[model samples]
Target chain A: MTTTTIPTLPAGRTIKLGLSRIRYEVKTYFRQGDAVFFSFLFPLVMLTIFSVAFSEQSFGSEAAPLSAAAFYLPGMLAAGLLLSGLQNLSIDIAGEKGDGTLKRFAGTPLPVLSYFIGKIGQVFATGILQAAMLLFVAGVVFQVELPSEPAKWATFAWVFLLGVSTSAILGIALSGLPRTGKSATAVIIPIALVLQFISGVYLGFSLLPEWLQNVASVFPLKWMAQGMRAVFLPEDFASLEQGGTWDLPGVLVVTAIWLVVGLAATRMTFRWIRKDS
Target chain B: MTTTEPVVSVRNLHKRYGSFTALDGVSFDIHRGETFALLGPNGAGKSTTIEILEGYRDRTSGEASVLGVDPGTGGLAWKARLGIVLQSTGESGNVTVREQLTHFAGFYPNPRDVDEVIAAVGLQDKQKTLIRKLSGGQRRRVDVALGIIGRPELLFLDEPTTGFDPEARRQFWQLIDSLKQDGTTILLTTHYLDEAAQLGDRAGVIAGGRLIDIGAIDEIGGAEARVPIVRWKQDGERKSVRTSEPGLVVAKIVAQLGEPEALEIIRPSLEDIYLQLVADHAAAEAADLMENAS
Candidate 1:
């Protein structure tokens, strides 16, 4: 006979199950040699290439090794998180759904919210670590100095949080569209390149055509990267670029707007599974 | 009170995806403590109805009550009372079976002891093994472990023994019998009719999004269900007869045949009755469609 006893807990609440799921998600995330390749190795390789290749593009007196690298560091960091939150997240989620993992979960008492919290939590924690690693390497290897002002550092933290949250929701939204891993990659890789090219990750907006710059400005990538540069790079150096003044309010607003839009898209596009497809 | 209410009551339930009517007016009630097997072919609205009753989908019209609560708006307390064992898969296989059971234990207010439940399902030795490493049967036991962890008042078993070998299937039936003895109401859906006869207290046959028959396992097809067909060849003359009292018919036939050439009486199994019922249902539906056209 099955014997059961009630556990002690508050009467009504969705047990966040947050910490438990995060622990499991991270454990599984690291176990896959493939995930480690995209989340960690990809960003490190990109950072090295940009810092080395553009070592001679001078910003003030020195070659752009430090300044250009520092300016684009946020984009590369966003790129690492985008790999975790957008590129890798969408494909893996779609694969799990196709593999019947999500259907298995539907049988449990675990809340629907747990999957999102656990996955995004893993990405967010990794995002923070990726950010820290970038800062450590930039400071130690390239000898780049962050702005001495306390306000800029605080601004950097908040903007990073908002940017990652927005990206994570977009990840879940995209997962609903593809049914297979091959299709997921086809959708993700091109979007990644297009956003990186236009948002000043590879080349500055000044070098891109006016029409392209105008298009890139509409994306959250541009604002997130520019906000990070405002915090780390010297103000006099940053002033050389147009609309380049440290727009703290603009960074917050753009990311916040994306966050809302991402959530709405999630509700509309999300499917537990496409029964017909 | 003579069976005051059914454990599950679904009335005039309808569901649509855009213009397609996935389920059109499906209705049935499962009585308390009865293992009512729902049998249907694929795309016959079997899954759609079950999903709605499980509170995973919403109905476009009509009402559904599982354990006296509308599943459409049912909350955690109500959900806690139902055990659902889905199709077995290795998706949650990264964790050991014991670890997996313990993790699910945290969700329900009252949950069966993880170690004890593991042993009940004959998985004690394999408790430390990752779910992925276990055999298909053992992984199915894990699915069972998670389902019954909460000691649910009602259990929904969806094709629980689909991949099981004969030995494993019998063992699973034993586990189910123990659960039934403890007064857990069960609603099962399967394509296997022998399984239904062996385990179900009652069975229901559904076709074309509607339930055509529901009753005790032996009486599912009414009086005609128990009747047997006697056949024989005497002096090169083939003969056959269908009668309700098979014993009397057999006795009379035996006297006439005098142990003559291959006299035999064949009784209908649940599988036979079930197939006949569904076939008759389809024929009736065709006739109705024809009549309406005229």
Candidate 2:
């Protein structure tokens, strides 16, 4: 063993823990092939399934063939983001927190705030990859044409970003809900399925019962999906419904509410380790 | 006891969990550069005290200072000076030994060089190997390396050598000694008495949320917890006596028995002292139980 004179160091500096945490997150996220394959890839596969299933169906002459497919494309994309963003995020974060990684970080000079920042960064970066993959497969295999207008693309970008961001916050908040990893899976898996079904990923919100639609709209998922359908489909496709236009303001409001709720949940929920909790 | 400032000082610390007293009026002092071992059995409030010191748990009442600042409110400056080696690592990862060390080093302002720390822990051969591939002992070395890489002035080691082989344990002792030589103060808690004896300048024994004994390693058990026990055969019958002066007792026994056969004078080890202390606490509790029953 070599003992060299360690140059004197000051202890007050902030540890750039975010970089390490982000690296760990990205690396570990890729290593979980089951989550990557099922959570991210399965949604792209779902896009094909949706496009093919809805390609020939006509919505009582108001909607043309493949028009319903276009409307649900963005919803499926939002679902893909949420699968990893909310479902996988909650499960993985809860698991890590349960396993003492968070506690170890608490002891270091590494700031916890940085970890949140890094998590957001990694999730968004991975979401872009998911978006790219979804767009590619949708264009090629599914014969689903993306919106070519700049205004619609702008709307799609805003809603998609807002959707994933809100979902990520919700993920962090949900992490504190389960004391153990297994319990987290039990809590999050059903919630993910419910979000997919009720939020218009598998079908339009109009197809669900009025009471369930009202209840689902109270959450961001429904508004986020509706907003995406508005963006990626024809301009008057929303008017083809009972409402002439999708509730743009509602998506903005619900996503904002989810963001605040997610942040508050994360702040309030302590990790598995507590001094006397 | 030369008027030197204590490195760690706690006064009247009280912690309670809904009616159960985890620590009650606990107080002690550890001087600079001294190894003060908090010795206790499971559920004896040792963890509570250590957690309070480590700034991981809050105290219900009273003042506690580690390196002259209360850990409960201590900020980054206070935390950076301290290094803690937890009982276990979090996960087995594919990150190489050097990679993990370097990653941990990034968290501190002034960390030891990555290669040097890996070498210091005697993992040169395994430096490039993934952490998951290493043996348990090698992984433990990585934990220690991360703890000391920041060149912390005060280190908290909790049962650090629990899973180490004998040779690795001895090497760990040498590393600790070298740290002491460099003027680092360590607060260690271990169940191993020999480790306490070999490393601690003073040992503090805690039982039932109370510090029952605290003194030099040699003085804790002898003449305090238990008298030295002398054993030998006396005319085909084995006899034992507890005495303050074990050497004198041995001399007398040798004279009477003409070089006593199977004779042995045994001083109380940290384990013996620990057991007696716990048993005494249990006996007191039993007496209290009987009194309350009546």
Best model number under lDDT: 2
Query: Whose DockQ is greatest here?
Result: 2
The DockQ values of the predictions, listed in order, are: 0.21, 0.28
Candidate 2 regions exceeding 4 Å error are: A1-16, A48-64, A67-72, A240-242, A270-272, B1-3, B88-96, B125-139, B222-230, B241-260, B288-294
Residue B279 lDDT (model 2): 86
Task: Assign candidate 2 its CAPRI class.
Answer: acceptable
Deviation (Å) of B188 in candidate 2? 1.1
Writing each residue's lDDT as its tens digit, candidate 1 over B1-294 gives 235578898888888888888777877788778788888777777777777888777788989988777877765567677898774455746778888888777777778899889988888899988888888878888888888998888898888888788887888889899999988899888888999999998877778877778788989988776688888887899888887676787687778766757777888989999889989988999999999999
Give candidate 2's iRMS in Å, 1 decimal.
8.1
Candidate 1 local lDDT, residue A276: 38
| RMSD list, candidates in order | 4.5, 4.5
Clashing pairs in model 2, backbone N/Cα/C closer than 3 A: A239-A244
How do the residues A217-276 of candidate 2 rate in per-residue lDDT, one tens digit apiece? 788888888887787766656864325678798789989999998988888884436767
lDDT of 2 at B155: 87
In model 1, what lDDT does residue A37 have?
82
